[model samples]
Target chain A: MEVAGLILIVIGTFFDLFGTIGLLRLPDVYNRLQASTKCVTMGTCLILFGFAVYSGFSPAGIKALICMFFILITSPTAAHALAKGSYRAGVQLANQSVCDLYSDKQVLKISAVMNRDVITILPDASLRQAIDLLVEKGITGLPVVDSEGVLLGIITEKDIIEYKTYGNVETAKVRDAMNINVQTLPPSAPLKELVSIFSQEDFRRVPIVEDGRVVGIVSRKDIIKFLKEEKK
Target chain B: MIEFITGVLLLSIFLALYRIGMGPTPSDRAVAIDILGILVVGFCVIISLATGRDFYMNVAISWSLLAFIGTIAIAKYLEGKGFDE
Candidate 1:
């Protein structure tokens, strides 16, 4: 039991160290904020849990658990309020940042006769390359992928265009600018489901994922093409 | 094991303190302070465990509560508001 407790403590300590490194190293404030809060909170909670395990259900362990509970509840709530407050207070990214949330329309103007190849950007690719892909491909966004073609996230033209951080946004890594929270679909889903999903959000495209890798993308134009074929 | 926990917490405290000192804006500092408060609770627990006492846990509990309240207040201040509001 003591060994188990020691192991948990050691792991939690490592988490805390990594989070601090992220806080010290990450270029942008938003990234720094998220990395620190996420890792630090988890680390501290784990430490408290370790103490509980070490001391058993005695008063000390119980107090440790109580502290852990307090931390788990309050930390995230505070971070959320802080994030929203920061955004509203105009604390942009590390540079002159803006989140033009309302300005762009999700107009998927690609022709129905589309190539199925899903364009992707590497995590390490400069945001400049991402912009070029968007412009050259005449598309609004591209999914970010690992070497294995695994879907990581999506970067839109808007993300790079307005992001003034770390340097010229062009020089910044796509990993920083890309939106990790992307909507994706499996090819097996029904077309009606796909259409309904498209109608639900402002994103112009959804990468088709199979076994965590991006195989294709579905855009508004593809939906239109599907409708045209159905009419026959 | 306890020594390792102590070292980690000490390092974390310094890092958070650095953030507070060098944080670009008030909000950044507030975040650093928030992190510091939570870290302190863990520190108190470590100290109590090492010292063979239960009083330290009491301190931890109170400290945790106070830290949460303090963070809430600081966050509000960052948003440009008074404490009463």
Candidate 2:
């Protein structure tokens, strides 16, 4: 074998070993992904190229060349998939993130959707009163707040129907019938996470809670509207 | 000659390993492991050439496939789970 061939092989191996060390030392998912993809792809490609050179254009060299190309094409793509999966999985950034560019900060802060003012209700409110408020506003449901204005539960038309289902609509207050176990979203919560929560849970209305107070309410309709707006 | 390349590859692998150890999160570690897998395949290919055997090339190809599958599976698991409030 030529001395140059041996040198090429040495260089390729060094690149690979260096990439492995990088994979072991990185600090976070995204950063690690960057290191992993860049180092591994380049390292492997060079190493394989070295093998092709050393093999003197034999069948093994051709195979090595093919594998090198395939790795070059697929390595970066696989890294991208890993990054996206990490994002969708709700992995938090390690350092102080400069900004969440993808989030709709305004929508999360807005008091209403499509200009319909969000309203609240109390747990002790009568079913008829709750129904009347819904009819007056032409809204589906309203978040229920306590005396301190903290979110306690939610009252929706579905709650009314369920109350009527057992023929127990008499003197029971909203506390007795309203869905207490609710899904609450923080102001910074992402819409994807919100959707996941809704899908995994049995709740229709989600309360937007900020600083332990009910800021707004999100219903199935709200989610639909948000999705529609996103599509547009 | 083979020994020198293998040794240098070992050194580079150590460097990647260092990155993995200092990673801050699981995703970071996952990425690092992926890079390591590619390095292994490259190493195998070189080994096939130095030793004049077709078998090592096959092993290298298989290693690449296995790495790809592992990466996809882990990514799927990450995306498939839902967050609880």
Candidate 3:
């Protein structure tokens, strides 16, 4: 048992040493976190396990077990938190990085692809008027804006369908059928954030706002187009 | 045998310190500090065995807890979204 424990400890020590070396040699903060988190956690846990094996069922062995469990739970979590925090804090990735999925390239910004000539409808516009504009423009949705172009809500085909099922479409107003709680993104937000929103939420289109006015709109088709271009 | 293990652990600790000293980012330093804490815990366990004193085991347990907490605190501070935020 002693010999086995000693061997384990020795191996673990090597892992710890390698982790330190990687930490020193890795190019960026993210890579360093990956190295240190994996190597050091494995090394420390192995050492503790070896200690437990040598000490048997004794109190010291039990303490070693507890320490092993603590290290297992805490080390990786701490590394993840630190990495996320560093990313959020705007720490630049290494220049050698081949690709950055989260990078906010100017080409991927909302302002780059969004249609600036948004065909919008006034809140008081009749459902017939909204439908005519949507059909004429061949669009699935339209932004409901005030006279000053401030976004009030969004009217989509789904809203029109729901409104038609309930009562007379001729009497219904755009505001009556439009979704009031609209999700808007800033023009400068990255395409990655938009992708996540599209995946997680039911929004088919996201309006881009600048200085409290709707500057442009991005839809699912726009994202598909962007991604297709990105592949090239 | 224990002496050899101690020597290796000490060497690793020194390497980790070198990282902490030269790490470019706060997260790198935080990782180094965490590795150093783990090494300290290993040292404490080995000492307890070599000296045949159960008291050292208790110290090891406390040290490990402190190290974990310290690493978490440093990580949170680096993240800038602490409890105050």
Candidate 4:
């Protein structure tokens, strides 16, 4: 019995050694956590079990058993708590991480919220028609498209009003008044990227483009509404 | 024979200490501390057996309890939460 117990202790110590190596060598906190937790549990439990076998039914032996039992319950719990806490603390994963299942709720895709019923104007249309479209649809901007549905430019209420200030709003074509340089996004872009774009001065809406055609549009209100829905 | 077991346990404890000193993140340190605590319990039992004294088992049990509680407390701190939660 003494021999057997000693052998178990030897094995347990070996596991402990391997665990420490893993803790030292693993790339990130999360990987180290799994390695250390499993190895430590095996090492300590075996050592305690060895003590029980060597001592038999004495008070110390029974206490070793109880201590081993306590360890069994608590080791995994501690590991779980540590993993959760580390993630909540925003500890980033290693550079080569292949999968991340935890951050999905926080990072949303643009397709989840963008309006598909895109209101567009022809570039050759009068600026008055773009203004009417903006007011009739209660939208701030319109993507100006060619006959082939390829985006030419974007016209907003501000554009017409600015044209009225310096140019001829009534006579100006949508091509004349429209801002050709506008921000666009792919449907797969993350909400984080959208937030940065919307933060720019005088930026309110962005068009979602697919195949060089305007597929949808997203405004600040869409993001605000998405956030409000998420809260609920 | 008992001396060798005790030596191995001591080595494991040192490894844990090495991690505690070297770990970059607070969570790594906490894990190292936890492993250290568990190793100490085994160390206490082996010591008690070597010395033929039973009181070290009591110390072992108490150490395990303290280790579990301490690990949990550190985890809560890392979670950016109050201990009361």
Candidate 5:
């Protein structure tokens, strides 16, 4: 029995090793996570099972069993954390991504604070790409625009979550998927006004428009940062 | 044999620590540190078994709890909120 247990442990170790290698070698974050999570989890469980058998009814076996239970609880949680981290970090998926999971239709037509530039997205942009942009830019919202740079709708993280519940499917297009009506703020608005907006409204972000075009985007965080810098 | 395995685990812990320290983003660091904590728990379990100690089992349990609490706190902080949030 002990000999059989040792063999199981060895086999488990090999599986874990291969998983780690896959984690290191995978080209994209999503694929890496998929490989590592499945491999390491199953590998670790088998190893613990082996240890349990090898140690028999002694305290060692009990300890091994407890460890296995803990692993079972935490491994998938860890994978969830990693996947969210990758998404929040703006890690891009490879070529096959089709759906845009992070766009909001309500807040399209955004203005950038740094050069007063506008962020526009087409209907066909994948949800993954939109999410990647949000993560990369650290922005809370974006403007959904058509090929003519005409504002169609807006998308935000909240929209993404809502959409996920609306469809059991993963595929969605921005034009068919965005909120048509959007609220806007002009560049001439005062800082105090922006603060009032936050207090009075549920939105965390707003677009600053000038001359019928987006010039800058302002968020609650940006306002807080501005105040902090001013205090210094 | 135990010593050899222990040594290898330590090496992996160091490598994981490096990732935590050098990760470009907050999430990367958070994940690495969390994994390292799990690895530490694994080490404690192994040590308890090898040494035939009931005391080490208690220690392992305490360590696991502490690590869990720490991971939760850090994750909350990363999310821009505290326990209440």
Candidate 6:
């Protein structure tokens, strides 16, 4: 029994040694956490188990068993907490990381939830026509486009209301009331970026442009829907 | 025979100390510290067996408890959240 226990202790020592090496050699915090948590925990537990075997059913043996159980439960939990905290603290991943499952699972690209069948109005179109389209389509905004489908500007419900309150609605064109300085995002933008933009700028919708052409649009409702789904 | 195992545990502790000294991040250091704590418990157990004194086992038990608590505390501090957080 003593020989068997010694063997186990030697094996555990090697495992512990390798775990420390891995902690030093791993590229990033996450990878290091993986090495130390698994390898060291297992190694320590083995040593405790070996000690228990050597001491038999004595108090020392029972105490060794208790210590092993404590280490087993606490070590992994603590490692998990640390890893999550480091991630949330904005520690950058290693450059060679092929994929980030955490962010990938939580964040969807703007293209994923963007409305591809966008409702757009021509710059030359009348305000009356723009309003008719807005009311008929039940949308708050429409992207203004040129004949070649290049984005010109955007007209929202607020623009129409402003024109109604001040300007002669009969003589107004969509270009006269549309916001020329519109904010647009690429389809590749992450949902987190979209959330920040929406919250900071209070935009009702943002146009998704590729090659300077409006390919899709994402509204506040779309973002809310996506977030609701993520909660599940 | 017991001396050989103690020597191995001491070597393992030395390796863990190197990591703790050169670890790039707080989490790495925390892991190293945790390993060192486990090794200390192992050392205590080995010493108890070598001397035929069961009292060292009590010391080992307390050392393990302290090590576990220290590991969790460091991890929590690194996480920058309260226990509930």
In terms of DockQ, the best-performing candidate is: 4
Candidate 5 chain B weakest lDDT stretch, 10 residues: B76-85
Model 5 Cα shift for residue B56 (angstroms): 3.4
Interface RMSD of 4: 2.2
Q: List, residue by residue over A1-232, the lDDT tens digit for candidate 4.
A: 9888878888988888788888878989999899988998899899899889988999989999999999999889988998898888878888555447897655578999999999898998988888888888898999988888888889887777777888877788899988988889999887767877788557789999988988999999988898899899
> What's the CA error at residue B37 for candidate 2, in Å?
1.4
Compared with the true structure, what per-residue lDDT tens digits does model 3 show for residues B10-82? 8888888988898777767777887788778878887887887877778877887887788777766766743
User: Which candidate's TM-score is highest?
Assistant: 4
Winning candidate number (lDDT): 4
lDDT of 1 by residue, B1-85 (tens): 6897899889988998998899887778877887788778778877886897988888888887888788777766667642235
Per-prediction TM-score: 0.57, 0.54, 0.57, 0.59, 0.47, 0.56
lDDT of 6 by residue, A1-232 (tens): 9778877877876777777677777888788779866887788788888888877898888988888887788777777777776776556788556457787565468898898999999988899999899889898999999988999999999988888898987889999999988889999977667777888896889999999999999999988887798699
Q: Give the winner by lDDT: 1 or 6.
A: 6
Give the per-residue lDDT digits (tens) of candidate 6, residues B1-85: 7777777677778877888888766666777787687777777777887898888878877887787777777766766643345
Q: How many residue pairs clash in each candidate?
A: 0, 32, 0, 0, 19, 0
Model 2, A1-232: lDDT tens per residue? 4566666666656556555555555445776667657866887887777777777678888888888887887788789888988887777764434346654564343244322345988888877788889899888778889888898888888888988888566666778778777778765665556666678887776777889987667777787887689798
> What ranges in model 4 sit over 4 Å off?
A105-232, B81-85
Better of 3 and 4 by DockQ: 4
Give the alpha-carbon lDDT of every model: 0.77, 0.72, 0.83, 0.85, 0.62, 0.81
Docking class of 2: acceptable
Kindly report which residue stretches of model 3 are placed more than 4 angstroms away from their true locations once superposed: A104-232, B81-85
Off by over 4 Å in 6: A104-232, B81-85
Model 3, CA-based lDDT: 0.83
By DockQ, the better pick of 4 and 5 is: 4
Clash list (residue pairs), candidate 3: none
lDDT of 6 at B25: 65
